[model samples]
Target chain A: MQNNWEKLNQELFTSSKRVIILSHRSPDGDSVGSSFGLYHFLKKFNHHVQVITPDPVPPFIHWIPEFETAINYEKQKDESFDAIRAADIIFCLDFNTPSRMGNMEFAFDRRSKDAYVINIDHHQQPDNFAHFQISDTSASSTAQLIFDFIIKTKGKTALDAQIAQCLYAGILTDTGSFRFSSTSPHTHRVVADLLETGIDVNAIYQKIYDNYSQDRIKLLGFALKDKLKLYPEYHTAIIDLSEKELNSFQFQKGDTEGIVNFPLSISWVKMSVLLTQKDGIVKMSFRSKGNFSVNELARNHFNGGGHENASGGMSTLSMQETLKQLESILPDYKQKLDESKI
Target chain B: MQNNWEKLNQELFTSSKRVIILSHRSPDGDSVGSSFGLYHFLKKFNHHVQVITPDPVPPFIHWIPEFETAINYEKQKDESFDAIRAADIIFCLDFNTPSRMGNMEFAFDRRSKDAYVINIDHHQQPDNFAHFQISDTSASSTAQLIFDFIIKTKGKTALDAQIAQCLYAGILTDTGSFRFSSTSPHTHRVVADLLETGIDVNAIYQKIYDNYSQDRIKLLGFALKDKLKLYPEYHTAIIDLSEKELNSFQFQKGDTEGIVNFPLSISWVKMSVLLTQKDGIVKMSFRSKGNFSVNELARNHFNGGGHENASGGMSTLSMQETLKQLESILPDYKQKLDESKI
Candidate 1:
């Protein structure tokens, strides 16, 4: 089944042409990892390759090799625009739709019209923007898909420590260090193959999980202690942090990234929500255990959607109003929440 | 070099015999993982196996397969004692000396005079009590050695998902989720092989890392917020949790396990000290980065020794006195600490 995509990707990579790899805005481990992993692989063929993200990579993930070289469209718009325009091939990674490209969508849409745009993602409902698409929703991470792409196009020998480290970091973080249900036996096998490349897994783990600042830890403490609210009857937990609270902590871009999943740690709690006021709107992240569909809930009520168990949404209303809206919707999910409980 | 031990292990395992696995007191992931890993491997051969820990396995690690079957010597003394007495072979895991077995050492010493004792561990300075020893301090975890032992004794085909999960958990936790220097490429290869057994890596990671209680996270919040103190000149950070503070959170045995390492995340910090008031004494944990030797400092000043980067100590003084004593000793280490800076 993948042979068709392999053939296309192989044909695309045959010559050393200018290439630009673009990951979605607010690039995560998967986005950065897949871009860099493919970048290193493509660089081997003497291609003029440049990796660009819609925004900056988080400090925790800065330890990835060649991370500093990736252009941030948010900071250096002109250079990023030029790279997108000059590229012969553009690898759009980790995201599906053009809307996910954020402010860079305009440039990407204009420049990539003539270039051979290839979409390699694990997200559901991929848009038909790419000329070549290799989307598998079951993949643990897009990094895993990139690994497969590398193995199929260039063979397994092409995976060096740098490439392996990037892919491993992608898979490790995206799968929550391999706890998510999306992780399969094949994921482990790929990890094993990557490990054989002599990449330091421990070093990478520290760079990702243990590189937090004192302020971040303190902010987490404050969030868990003061902001968390629980409604045990609905098996729901929410932690809401206002912009003022974030400013007090001097919050960076990725500081509150994993805070949404913390509430799901409670044995009784099946649904966890994190509502953080960012810019003019409140951004909401939804996480749940078992079969309760946070995707449907987010899409129907909050104008957003993602994976079945995990999803994102936004609210234009005030924090109080959003809280009221969330409270009102709990009754509709009572039976689903109760059934999903351990 | 492992070939000799493998031969001896194979000879010992030729016949179906009663096997009792003994781990050190206050059983950690490595201790429990190795014990259970070997238990499952031997069970495949129809051997009568019972694992006994001096105390209860911590709740976070309770999800390991067949964990409930492992007897706790502190709670089920009679059964544990009888198992030791009836054993034909004793597998001592993750401990250097018999004293580490706590009260169970007396029973082990009495019963093991006739039974074959095999020491499989990664700790430094292992005592020469075992008839056969496969002690390698370079190994990331004792569970890694157990995986080698299984492959050598029964071949790689003996590895199943259950055994692989146990071994993987040990390596994951012991290596601080593959962030420690002890995690060599070989350690990763072993992990890769384990993953190939169809063990769910994500599920195992969740069972080990994500199973924290609300009280534990809250305790962590308090420790970081109110308890943390820094000695900038010495590049030292300390977090002291008092008995009252612990009681407020209803702290369990392993609640404060990794709190010491949190301070080490600071880029400029060279050493981290965790002082917790327990029983009548103030228990201390020391951690350092680079060439600094926390083990030497703990041994000479705090009456404890362990690894080079990580070690444990204890002080019989009050919290105030202990803090003062620690402060007084910082001057002596100032030169070494400054020299060790990255």
Candidate 2:
């Protein structure tokens, strides 16, 4: 299996140039991270490499290597889409389908006619547009596959501080600093490999995880104090932020990033949601514990599907209307939770 | 040194009936942690144990084992002082002189006249009040000494989950999760031993460090956004909070905890200060990098002394006056920082 992966990687690298790596919309730590990690790897081999995302990198994502280089097509009106059109190979990472790319789907489709699209992702299934799809759902992050690629195909000596830092960021954020259930001994081995780079792990941790703006923290405080809504019997938690409240707090693009995770801390709360108004659309994030599949719930009810533990969607309806829909379905989830004794 | 400490601890444990374990005034993570660690240890031996503090346990100190049981003499008006007066042993941990005990000095002096006072602390210098003093300034925390006592005297087999949790808290906070300069191989060994008890390491980390109330975070936001005052040329950062702001934010004891460390991230800043109003006393905390000794700076300038990197003190002047003083002395420290080229 390992030899086959190396052969495939070698073939892909040899035959391709002007490689573009892409991740999902609203790129998170994993998607942005894995995409950038691959971007750097291709750059090392003198390939004309670029990483493009649908949305701007979030503030928390700023700590990752070469984040400033990630061009958001929406922001760069002058960006030559010619790079994508001229590319020989386009690598799509951390996502399965073109629709998951949001507005980037058009560019991806247009470029695929000229270039062989290689899907190197850690998600279920693959888009039919890809000629070579290396989708491993069992892998925690696409970066992990890239790490194996660097070691097995390239060489362990190829792993530099920059690459190690990028990989570490992906592994650390995705595993919640090795606290999440997804973490395994393989994750520790990856971390141990990164630590061998002598990257001053403490400073990196302080910079990435510990550092936070007082205003963002205050915004969180205000949400919890006045806006948090909890349904104890239903074991559900909800937090809402209107555009006016966000504006008043001078909210940055990524200010509400991890607010959804806070609610799940309540021992009884099996699921959590954070509803916010962004660009005139009501954005809702769903998170769950145990076997409660937020992706299934969001995809079936709202127009969204993600991992089993987390999912997100946008609604044309007002938050009030969304709450009514949620209220109707919450009782069924509560019953399921009770039956599972969670 | 080992034989003497072991003999003293053994004698105290065997003869003492009602023992009082006292931490420092304005108890912090290490002080309260060591106090509670020893409290739980003595309780396991079926000794009558009462943990005492001069003031209330600071909010950040809740990570200590059985911290809820710590008695605040300042808050308890109805409780008899006679209970302390009749104790066979008084174990003073994490403090040296009675002057540092604040209001508890009167009670401590009265109780120790007939009792065996064993001072088990991790501080510089000592007074002649105690019959036995195990004050090793080299130790990261008194809990480190307590762990040593447990291994050499109580035996390694005596360690259990609760005791391990307490000891882990002490070592973790004092060493900044094994990132600080004081962190040694012995600290790692202590952590390894704690893990042997099957205590969930991640759970303890989440409970202590990850547990953040939104309100406190908001207060932090307000401080950074509005309260931050910096001498950019001096590479000195200061955040001064007024009593009115504290009251409006509903500031508790630990509201500004770890707030001082944020400013040091800016590459230019060599030192930082967090000044807040506590009972009208200008409470100032200092943090520094490299060889800049905040302990000496705090002691000489602000009536505070602590480790080389971190320290605190109280000022008789108002918060505004204190800020003024800090600004006046800025140029000297600025020159020092420049000389260090840090």
Candidate 3:
């Protein structure tokens, strides 16, 4: 018996049918785009494929075609859950831990006994539960890895506009439009490959980047005018968006996107904070420069920890409590900041 | 009688007891950063140097130390003008046209007859009026060229911390924090060189990108949420900010920066517009994708032009009139967009 991925990929053109894809909770661009991009590739083979996510995708990301057909597990209690049980192969994207899978963890666990699980992720320390574990930390996103996987598995040289569009979204959002440190030469080559498909790069860029609501713009204006706080001495800046203010702006789910970067502009300000309200809970995202260690801050102070420079934490406390907690630790990093002045 | 730039550069090093450096109108990152970077470099030689700009440098750009000393031409009147006239050398950076020199254009024209003028710019079609034109359009910004010029003139192999900070700003702003298409390998090498000087790249990124006013964020929110309009058939998206709304948000200058890309996220939208009110004039910036010609739109339609994909224009009409004009031409591009769909 050959490996599950090798056997499936080898015979995909012949008999592989009825595939289903699932991404981790809070499906980021990489997971969403990768799963959908693969869905598009499989569609050409006349395979019936459905993309499922535990929660609703971000509003700004509604532009993806795969998102239209995505099965909401919470909403479609019977169909989406039943569809997973019937699928031959379950492709899991961008998750290494079951806890990160949100509500789908139970369904995935139940389906593992019968269906094949093909794990594709870029995160560190993946669980040893999948039939096929193809993970690369050096890769910018799971979408990039999926692009290569599609090429190698199918042995196809042709890529259509839909395929190109999804791949572009995957590469773009993952790399922060290609400015993040993870962007490598291979990433550029992948982009070049996608571009060769004659998918309008500008169209893709515009659709994925430009659409915004007037209310969101108004909310950002309110934040900059009234909510931003700066600490020049400690080289720190914070922006607090109260729940009332968010509601007044007709707060859409994804309106807080890119709001955190604004506070990071003050001269000598190294640590920036964005505290926003979501469902009576405060979500604080910390962005830092140099050795400020945002992950450590989130881990020690809040109910979260992520990458070193960019990370997030959650708190049941009010916006004031979150700010108060952050300010308490400001003194600890002051001397380190002064010694490393550029 | 070597031409003025050679004469002035020589004098600036040899006999210059004092000097004041200034950039053109609407001082961008390259011009401001280059001027201040050079100011810091000359300070080590005990030369009295001040960085001046015709426009008020926005608070977001306060990271540069010399921003504190940038004398606004309008406020200083005769005193600062006299100092500039008395200087042995004037390094006019990043502006090839005289109009771009703003209120100080007349002063530069008058005093530069005797004083030396070294035109360091990255823009194409340099004005023949400059005595010394070390202009390279291929370079990312005038700051990178200035970095090269500094190494060549000073005969030094290494850049100091102040110089590194200044150079980094030029690179950061001009490249849209390294996300713009202009970022090249040479640009990366210059960044690496700056990093070698022990400048905190993270801190620089934080100050330039992460810092924001709550008002600005609120303004951005308003622009994206309410003002953005997308025309899918014509592959066009527009974010129109009126004077009334700007005032309502307590909008300061530089609030709409990077707000243009927000509306481009709608799939199939190839061209994006950012229209706003500035000094009672309506300004329009056009960004496009694929073969969409925003430069042509700006030139033939809006009395301005730029590169094929990214361009800008201006109009005296109110926001309503500008929309009417855009609607008139938008239908014409529909056919071309439809043809490119294949």
Interface RMSD score of each model: 3.0, 5.6, 5.9
Report the Cα lDDT for candidate 2.
Answer: 0.73
Model 1 spans with C-alpha error above 4 angstroms: A1-14, A112-114, B1-14, B76-79, B184-186, B192-198
What local lDDT does model 2 show for residue A72? 81
Candidate 3 Cα deviation (angstroms), residue B239: 11
lDDT of 2 by residue, B1-342 (tens): 223665566656665478888777777777777887788888877788998888777555575667777778788733526556878888888888888888777787778466878887777787666877777777867788889878867798888888887887787677676555455445556665766776665566656664455456556656665666667687777888888888887777666777888677555567888988878888888988666888888988888898787898889998878888888887777667776533
> What lDDT is obtained when candidate 3 is compared to the true structure?
0.75
Ranked candidates (DockQ, high to low)? 1, 3, 2
Candidate 1 achieves a global lDDT of: 0.85
Index of the highest-lDDT prediction: 1
Answer with 1 or 2, whichever has the higher TM-score.
1
lDDT of 3 at B275: 90
Per-residue accuracy of model 1 over A1-342 as CA lDDT, tens digit each: 233565465656677888899999888889998889998998999899899888877887787888888889999999999889888888899998989999999889779456878899999888887778888999999999999988877799999999999999999889877667687767767887888888767667757776667787778878777777889899898998999999999998878988888777766778999999988699999998778899999999999988888899999998889989999999999998888734
lDDT of 3 at A80: 73
Deviation (Å) of A300 in candidate 1: 2.4
Work out candidate 1's RMSD over C-alphas. Answer: 2.9
Candidate number with greatest TM-score: 1
Which of the two candidates, 1 or 2, achieves a greater lDDT against the reference? 1
For all predicted structures, in order, the TM-scores are: 0.91, 0.67, 0.64
